[model samples]
Target chain A: MSRQNFEEQLDGLHRQLMSMGTLVEEAIHKAIKSLVERDRELAMEVMKNDQLINQMEHEIESGCFRTIALQQPVGGDLRRLGTMLKIVTDLERMGDHAVAIAKTTTRLMAEPYVKPLIDIPLMADHVKAMVRDSLNAYIAKDDQAAGRIAAQDDVVDKLYAKIFRDLIEVMSKQEHTINQGTHLLLVAQYLERIADHVTNICEWVIYMTSGQKTDLNK
Target chain B: MSRQNFEEQLDGLHRQLMSMGTLVEEAIHKAIKSLVERDRELAMEVMKNDQLINQMEHEIESGCFRTIALQQPVGGDLRRLGTMLKIVTDLERMGDHAVAIAKTTTRLMAEPYVKPLIDIPLMADHVKAMVRDSLNAYIAKDDQAAGRIAAQDDVVDKLYAKIFRDLIEVMSKQEHTINQGTHLLLVAQYLERIADHVTNICEWVIYMTSGQKTDLNK
Candidate 1:
C-alpha cells in the first residue's frame, strides 16, 4: 500500500475509535441520568446498547491488528495503533462502570433521597470532557491539548475527595442512608476512574508524540 | 543474539513478570487485611509499596520493548511477550485498585463500622485467590486452572451484591452509619474490580495459548 493509503487507513481507524468514544460517553451520561430520574427504560437502553460498544471495541482491535500485519506500522504509526488499542480497552471498561452505576440507580429508585446527587453529575461532565479532549488530541497530534485535559483530571480527583467526605457525613447522620449512600459513592468513584483512564490515554498521546513518558497530573 | 540466549532472556523476563505479580498480590492481601483489622500501619505499608508496583510496570514495559527490538521475536515468543506486556498493565492497575481500597480503609479508621465487615473481607479473599490462581495459570500454561479462576469471579460479584444490600439496611436503620458504610462499600467495589482484572488476565492467557479469545465468564 502507498503511504497515502496507509495514512488514510490510520485516519479511518482513528475516526472509528472516536465514534466508539462518543457512544461510551453518551452511554455514561444517559446511564447516570437514568438513575437520577428513576427512568428504568433509559437504564435498560444503556444495558442493551452495551453490545454495540463491545462490538466497536472488537472491531477497533481487529483494525489495529490488520494495520500491524499489513502496514507493518513502525515509529509513530506503531505507537498510535498500540495506544488506541490500550485506550479503547479503558474506554470499554468505562462503559462497564457506567452500566454498573445505572444498575445501582435502578435498585435505589425506591429509596428516599439520602442527599442530592449534585457532585456526581458534575464529575461526569468533567469525565466526558476529558474523554472528548483526549481523542481530539490524538487526532490532532496536539500534546499541549492532551496535557491540558490531563491536568483537569486532578480537579476530578479533588471532587471525588469532597463527594466521599460528604457521603460519609450523610451516612453518619442517617443510618438508613448507608446502603444507598455507598452506592452513590461508588458511582462517583467509577466516574473518577473513567477520568483517570482518560488521563492515561492523554499520557499515551504524549508518549506517541514525544517518545517520553510524563505524568501530566504532576 | 543467539537463539539460546534469546530464549533465556525471554524466560528471565517471564520470571520477573511473575515475581512482580507475586509482589502485587501480597500487597493487595495485606492492604485488605489491614482494613479488616483496622491496622493503620499495614495500610501505610500498602501505600508505600505502590510506588514499587508502578516502577515494576515501567520496567516490564521497557524490558518487553527491548526484547522485541533486540531479539526480533516472532511467532510464539512474540505473542508471549506481547501478552506479558498487556497482563503486566492489568496487574499494575489491580495494584492501584488495592491501594485505593487501602486508602479508603485508612480514612474510615476514624469512623465507626456499620457491621462486622464479614462480606468485605470475604470478597477480598476471593479476589486475592483469583489473582494468585490466574498468575499461577499463566506461569504453568494451565488453561483449565485459569478457566476455573475466571469462573469463580461470580462469587465475588455475588458477595458484593449481598454486602451492598446489607449496608443499605444499616444506613436506613441508623442515619449515622452513612460515612463508614460508604467507605466500606468502596473497598468492596475495588476488590470486585480487582477480580474482574484477574479474569481479564486469564482471558489474555487463553488467547496467548490457544490463539483464541474466549470469555471465560460465560
Candidate 2:
C-alpha cells in the first residue's frame, strides 16, 4: 500500500475508535440513567447497544491486522497500530462494564433502592470524563493529557470507597437492604473498573507516544 | 532476522508467556489460600509477586513487537504474534484480579469465618482450570478445545450466582457479617472475572486458528 493510502486507513481506524468511544460513553451514561431512574427499557437498550460496540471493535481489530500485514509499519507507525488494538479492547471492556451496570439495574428493577443513588452517579460522571479525555489523548498523542486523566482515577477510587462504606452500613442496619446493597456495591465497582480501564488507555497512549510502558494505574 | 532466528524468538516469547501464566496461577492460589486461611503474609506475597507478572507482560510484549517489526510476518505467523500480544494482556488481567482478591483478603483479615470458604475456592478451581486449558488451547491452536473451555464458563457463572446468594443470605441473617460478607462477595466476583478473561483467551485462540471473531462470552 502507498503511504498516503496507509495514512488514510489509519485515519479511518481512528475515526472508528472515536465512534466506538462515543458509544461506550453513551452506554455508561444510559446504564447509570437506567439505574438512577429505574428505567428497564433504557437498561435493555444499553445491553443491546453493547453488541454494536463489540462489532466495531472486531472491525477495527481486523483493519489493524490488515494494515500491519500490508504496510509492514515499523517504529511509530507500528506502535500506533498496536495501541489502537489495545484501545479498542479497553473500549470494548468498558462497554461490557456498562452492560453489567445495566444488568444490575434489571436485577433491582422490581424493588426500591436501599438508598437514593448519589455517589454512584458521581462515580459514573468521573469515569465518563476519563473515557472522553483518554480517547482525545489517544488522537492527539498527548501523553501529558493521558497523565492528567490517570490522576483523575484517584477521585473515582475515593468515591467508590465512600459508596462502599455507606452501603455496608445501610445493609447491616436493615436486613432487607442486603440484596440491593450488594448489587449497588457491584455497580460502584463496575464504574471504578471503567475508570481503571481509562487508566489502561492512558498507559497505552503514553506507550504509543513515548515508547515507554508507565504504570499510570499506580 | 532469519526464519530460524524468528522462530527461536517466537519460542522464547511463548516460554515467557507460559511462565507468566504459571505466576498468575500461583497468585490465584495464594490469594485464595490467604483468604481461606486468613494468611495475611500469603496475601502480601501475592501482591508483591504481581509485579513480576507485570514485568513479564512488558518483556513478552516488547519481544512480540520486535519480532513482528523485524520479521514482517504475514498470515499465520502474524496472527500468532498478535495472539501472543493479546494472550499476555488476558494473563496480566487475571493477575490483577488475583491481586484484587488478595487485597480483599487483607481487608477481611481480622474477621472470623462468615462461612467456610468452600464455594470461593471451588470457583477458583474452575477458573484456574480454564486458565490452564486456555493456554494449552493457544499452544496447540485448538479451536475445538477453545470452544470447550468457553463452555466451562457456564459452570463458573453458576458457581458465582450461588456464592452471591449464599453470601447475601448470611449477611441478612447476621448483620455483623455484612462487611466481611461483602468482601467475600467481591472475592467471588474477582474469580468470576478471571474466568471471563479465560473466555477472552479462548476467543483469541479461536480467532488465531480460524480467523474468525467469536463471542464465546455469551
Candidate 3:
C-alpha cells in the first residue's frame, strides 16, 4: 500500500475503534441505569449488545493483523497498530464486564432493595467519562489530555473507598439489605475497574507517542 | 543477531515471562491469604512486591522490542513475542489489582467483622488455579488445557453470584454489617477480575498458537 493509503487506513481503523468505544460507553451507562432503575428489559438489551462488541473486537484484531502482514508497518506506525490491538481487547473486556453487571442486575431484579443507588451510578458516570476521554486522547494523540483524564481515576478510587465504608455500615446495621448491598458493591467495583482499564489505555497512548512509558495514574 | 543466538534470547525471554507469571500468581495468592488471615504484615509485604511486578512488565516489554528489532522474527516466533507483549500487560494489571486489594485489606485491619470469611478465600483459590493452569498451558503449548481452564471461569462467576447473595442477606438482616460486607464484596470482585485477566492471557496464548480467536468464557 502507498503511504497515503496506509495513513488513510490507519485513520479508518482509529475511527472504527472510537466507534466501538462509544458503543461500549453507552452499554456501560445503560447497564448501570438498568440496574439502578430495576429495568430488566434494558439489562437484557445490554446482554444482547454484547455480541456486537465481541464481533467488533474480532474485526479490529483482524484489521491489526492485516495491517501488520500486508502493510508491514514499522516504527511508530507499528507501535500504533500494536497499541490499538491491545486497546480494543481492553475495550472488549470492559464491555463484557458491563454485560456481567447487567446480568447481575437482572438477578437482583427479584431481590429487595438495600441502599440508595447513589455511589454506584456516580462511579459509572466517571468511568464513562474516562472511556470517552481516553478514546479522544487516542484519536487526537493528546498526551496532556490523556494524562489529566488518567489522574482523575483517583476520584473513582476514593468513591470506591467511600462506598465500601457506607455499604459496610448498612450491612452491619440491617440484615435485610445484605444481599442487595453485596450486588451493588460488585457493580461499583466493576465500574471502578472499567475506569482503571481506561487509564491503562491512556498510558499506552502516551507510550506510543513519546516512546517513554509513563504512569498516568500519577 | 545470529538465528541461534536469537532463539536463545527468545527462549530466555519466554522463561522470564513465565517466571514473572509465577511471581504474580504468588503475589495474588499471598495477597488473598493476607486478607483472609488478616495478616497485616503480609499485606504490607505484598504491597512492597508491586515494584517487582512493575519492573518485570517493563523489562519483558523491552525484551519483546529488542527481539523483534534484532531478529526480525517471523511467523510463530513473531506471534509469540507479540502475544507475550499483551499477556505481560494483563499480568501486570492483575498484579496491580492484587496490590489494590492488599491496600484495602490493610485499611480494614482495625475494623470489626460482619461475617467470617468463606467465599472470598474460595474465590481466590479458584482464581489461583486458573492462573496456574493458564500459564501452564502457555508454557506447555496446550491449547486444549487453556481452553478448558478458560471455560472454568464460570466457576468463579457462579461463586461470585453465591457470595453476592450471601453477603446481601447479611446486610439486609443486620445494618451494622454493611461496612464489613462491602469490603468482602470488594475482595470477591477483585478475585473475580484476576480470574478474568487470567482468562485473557490464556485466550492470547490460544490465539498465538492457533491464529484463531476464541471465547473462553463460552
Candidate 4:
C-alpha cells in the first residue's frame, strides 16, 4: 500500500475511535442523569448502548490488526496505532463503568436519594472534559496539553475524597442511608476511575509524541 | 531476522508478560493477606511494590513497540503482540487495585473486625486463581479454557454481593463499624474488579486465538 492510503486508513481508524469516545461520553452523561433525575429508562438505555461502544471498539481493533499486518507500521505510525488501541480499551471500560453506574441507579430508584448528587455530577463533568481534552491532545500530538489534561485528574480525585467523607458521615448518622449512600459512593468512585482513565489516555498521548514514559497520575 | 529469531523474540516477550502476571498475582495475594491478617506492614509492602509492577509493565510495553517497529510482525504473530500488550495493561491495573486494597487495609487496621472476613478472602482466592488460569489459558492458546476462566468471574461477583449485603447489615446494626465496614466493602470491590480484569485477559486470549470479539463480562 502507498503511504497516502496508509495515512487515510489510519485516519479512518482514528475517526472510529473518536466515535467510540463519543459513545462513552454519552454513556457517562446519561448514567449520571439517570441517577440525578431518577430516570430508570435512561439508565437502561446507557446499559444497552454499551454493547454498541464495545462493537465499535472491537471493529476498530480488528482493523488496526489488519492494517498492522499488511503495512507493518513503524515509528510514529506504529505508536499512533498502539496508542489508539490502548485508548479504545480505556474508552470501552469507561463505558462499562457507566453501565455499572446506571445499574446502580436502577437499583436505587425505589429509595429516595440520601443527599443531592451535586458533587457526583460535578466530578462527572470534570471527567467528561478530561476525556475530550485527552483525545484532543492525542490528535494534536501536544505533549504539554496532555500533561495539563492529566493534572486535571487531581481535581476529580479531591472531589471523590470529599464525597466519600460526606457519605461516611451521612451513613454513620442515619443508618437507613447506609445502603443508598454506599451506592452513591460507588458512582463517584466510577467517575473518579473514568477520569483516571482519561489521564491514562493522556499519558499515552505524551508517550506516543515524545517517546518518554511519564506517570501523570503522580 | 529469520523466522526462528522472530519466534524467539516473541517467546522472550511472552516470558516477560508471564513475569508481570506473577508479580500481579503476588500483589493480589499479599494485599488480601494483609487485610485478612490485619498486617499493616504487608499492606504497605504491597503498596510499595506497585511501582515495580508499573516499571516492569512500561519496560515490556516499550520492548513491544521496539520489536514491532524493527521486526514488523505479521499475521498471527502481530495479534499475539497485540494480545500481550492488552494483557500487560490488565495485569498492571490489577496491581493498582491490589495497592488500593492494601491502602484500605492500612486505613482500617485500628478498627475491630466487623465479621470474620470469610467471604472476602474467599473472593480473593478466586480472583488469584483466575489471574493464574487466565495466563495459563493465554499461554496455551486454549480459547475454551479462556472462556471457562471468564465464566468463573461469576463466583467473584456473587461473593462480592454477599459481602456487600453482609457489610450493609453490620453497618446498619452498629454505627461505629460503618467506616471500617465500608472500607471492607471497597476491598471486596477491588477483588471483584481484579477478577473482572482476569476475565479481560481471557477475552483477549479468545480474541488472539479465534479473532472473534467476545464479551466475557456478560
Candidate 5:
C-alpha cells in the first residue's frame, strides 16, 4: 500500500471510530434518561442499539487488522492503529455498561425510586463529557487534553462513592428500598465504570501521541 | 525475522501470557479467600499483585505489537496475535475485578458473617475454573473447549443471580446487614464479570481458530 493510501485508510477508520463513539455516548445518555424517566421503551432501545455498536466494533477491528496486514505500519502509524483497536474495545465495553444500566432501569420500573435521581445523572453527564473529550484528544493527538480528561475520573469516582453511601443509608432505613437501592447502586457503578473506560481511552490517547504509558486510572 | 525466529517469538509471548494467566487465577483465588476468611493480609497481597498483572499486560502487549510490526504476519498468524492482544485485555480485566473484590474485603472488615459466604466462594471457584479452562483452550487452539468454557458462564450467572437475591433478602430483613450485604453483592458481581471476561476469551479463541466471530457472551 502506498503511504497516502494507508493514511486515507487510517482516516476512514478514525471516522468510523468517531461514529462508534457517538453511538456509545448516545447509549449512555439514553440509558440514564430511561432510568430517570422510567421509560421502559427507551431502555429497550438502548439495549437493542448496543448490537449496532458491537457490530461497528467488529467492522472497525477487521479494518484495523486488514490495514496492518497490508500496510505493515510501524512506529507512530502502528501505534495509532493499535490505539484504535484498544479504544474500540473500551468503547464497546462502555456500550455494554450502558446496556447494564438500561437493564437496571427495566428492573426498577415496577416501583418508585427511593430517592430522586440527581447524582447518578450528574455522574453520567461528567462521564459523557469525558468520553467526548477523550475522543477529541484522540483525533487531535493531544496528550495534554487526554491528561485533563483522565483527571476527571476522580470526580466520577467521588460521585459514585456518594451515591453508594446515600443508597446504603436509604436501604438501611427502609426495608422496601433495598431491592431498588442496590440496583441503583449498580447503575452508579456502571456509570463509574464507563468513566473508567474513558480514562483508559485517555491513557491510550497519551500513549499513542507520546509513546508513554501513563496510569491515569489511579 | 525468519519464520523460525518469528515462531519462537510467538511461543515466548504465549508463555508470558500463560504466566500472566496463572497470576490472574491466583489473584482470584486469594481475593476470594481473603473475603471468605476475612484475611486482610491476603486481600492486601491480591491488591499488590494486581500491579504485577498490569505490568505484565503492558509488556506482553508491547511484545505483540513489535512482533506484528516486524513479521507482517497475515491470515491465521495475524489472527492468533490479535487474539493474544484481546485475551490479555480480558485477563487484565479479570485481575481488576479481583482487586475490586479485595477492596470490598477491606471495606467490610468491620463486619461479621453475612450468611457465611458459601455461594460467593463457590461462584469464585467456578469463574477461576473458567479462566483456567479458557487459557487452556487458547493454548491448545481447542475451539470446542472454548465453547464449553463459554457455556460455564451461564453457571456463573445463575450463581450470581442467586447470590443477589439471597443478599437482598438478608439485608431487607436485617438493617445491620445492609452495608455488608451490599458489599457482598458487589463481590458476587465482580465474580460474575470475571466470568463474562472469560467468556470473551472463549469467543476470541473460537475466532482465532475458525476465523469466525461468534458471540459466546450471549
Candidate 6:
C-alpha cells in the first residue's frame, strides 16, 4: 500500500532470496562432499531436500507477482523484482545440478572411484564461491562485483577441460574404467553448468543496475 | 494506456516471443541436422547464428522493461510481461544447448560411425516437437495443453536413458570409440536438457494463466 511498506516487502524479498541462495550453496557443498567422501546418506539427504529449494523458488516467485500487482512498482523497484525472478531460477537450477551431482554420487557408491576426484571437488568449491559472490553482488547491487565474479567461470571451465582430458585418458587405457569415468565426467559437466548459472546471475545484476544486456559467460 | 492498448502490446510481445522460440527451434533442428548428416558447415552455421538468438532475447527483454516502465502494467498484464521475460531466458538457454550440441558435432566430426544413430535423431525430433508444442500451448493460454506437452518430457527422458545405456555399452566394448561415444552421449544429454527447458515454458504458461506455480517437469 504505502511506499514504505513496499520497500519493506522488497527488502524482505531480498532476504528470502539470499536465504534461497544459501540453501543452494549448501546443497552444492553437501552434494560434492558426499561425492568426495562416498557418503550415500548425505547424497540422499541432498536429493530429498531439493524439494525445499523448489518450494522457496515458487514462494519467491509468488511474492514477486504480488508485489507487482499491489504496488505497481516502477523503474528501479520494478527491475529489482523482475531480476530476482531470474536470479532465483538460476539458483534453483544450481540446486538441481547439485541434486544431480548427489544422484551421481549415489549411483557410483558401490564402484571404486576411477580417480581421486581432486579436480572435481576443487571445481565444486570454486563454483560454490561463485554462487556466494554472485548473491553478494546482487544484495549489494554491485555491478563491478558481479563482473569480477563472472570472470571466475573461466577457472571452472579450465578445470572441466582438465577433468575431461584426464577421464578420456583413463577410459582409453583401462577399459574397465569407462563406465565410472563417464559418470565422473558428467559430474564435472554438472559443476561447469552451475558455474554458467552463476554467470547468468552476474549478467542479471549488470542488467538490473545499468540496463545493459551483456553475456558475462561469453 | 487503455486496456485495448495494453492488449495490443501484449500481442506484440507474444508474437516476438514466438519468433524467438522459432529461432531456437530452428537452431535445434539445424544443429541436430548437422550432427546426423555430419555436415560441418551446417554445424558451424548453427554456432555462428547463436548470436542472433542472443540479440533477439535482449531486444524482447528491453521491450518488456520499456512496456513496464511506461505503461505500469498491473495484475495479469504485469505477470504476463514477467512471465515472458522468464520464457525468453528459457528459450535462449535452449538455444545455448543447441549450440553446445553443434560444438559436440564439430568435436566428433573426424570420428567414424558410432552405431547407426537412429535413437539420437529420434530423441531430437521428439524434443523439437516439445519445443513447438510448448510455444503453441503458451500462445493459446491452454493450461491443459501446457500440462499435456509437459508430460511428453517423460518420453525424452526415457530416450536419453536408452542412449546413455547404449553408449556406455559401445564405449565399454571398444576403446577408440570412447571419445566419440562420450560426445554422442553429451549430445543426447543436451537434447534432454532442451526438453527440460520446454517443460519450463509449459510451467510458465500454466502459471501465466492460473497465477499458480507448478513444476511440470516433476
Q: Can you give the DockQ of every candidate in the order shown?
A: 0.44, 0.87, 0.48, 0.85, 0.85, 0.72
User: Best candidate per DockQ, number?
Assistant: 2
Pairs in clash, predicted candidate 2? none
- Give the fraction of reference interface contacts each candidate recovers: 0.42, 0.76, 0.47, 0.89, 0.76, 0.74
For the predicted complex of model 4, DockQ is 0.85
> B-chain TM-score, every candidate?
0.95, 0.98, 0.95, 0.98, 0.98, 0.97
Tens digits of per-residue lDDT for model 6, A16-92: 99899999999999999999999999999999889999999989988987888788787788888889989999999
Cα lDDT for residue A183, candidate 2 = 92
TM-score, structure 4 vs. true: 0.98
Candidate 5, residues A48-126: lDDT per residue as tens digits? 9999999999999999999999999999999998999899999999999999999998999889886689999999999
Q: Return whichever of 1 and 5 wins on TM-score.
A: 5
CAPRI docking class of candidate 2: high
Question: Residue-wise lDDT of candidate 4 within A1-218, one digit each (tens)?
Answer: 99999989988997888788888999999999999999999999998999899999999988888888788888889898998889899999999999999999999988888667899999999999898889888888899999988988889999999999999999999999999999999999999899989989998999899888787876
For candidate 2, the C-alpha RMSD (Å) to the true structure equals 0.9
> How well is each residue in B1-218 modelled by candidate 4, as lDDT tens digits?
78888878888887888898899999999998998899999999998999999999898888888788878888677888899889888999999999999998889877779678799888988999899899989888999999988999888889999999999999999999989988899988989999999989999999989888889997
Question: What's the lDDT for all of these models?
Answer: 0.80, 0.93, 0.82, 0.90, 0.93, 0.90
Each model's TM-score, in the order given? 0.90, 0.99, 0.91, 0.98, 0.99, 0.97
Ranking by DockQ: 2, 4, 5, 6, 3, 1
> Model 4 Cα displacement at B154 (Å)?
1.1
The DockQ of predicted model 5 stands at 0.85
Backbone clash tally (model 5): 0
Clashing pairs in 4: none
| CA deviation > 4 Å runs, candidate 2 | none
Instruction: Assess the local accuracy of residue A193 in candidate 2 as a C-alpha lDDT between 0 and 100.
Output: 94
**What's the true lDDT of residue A56 in model 4?**
94
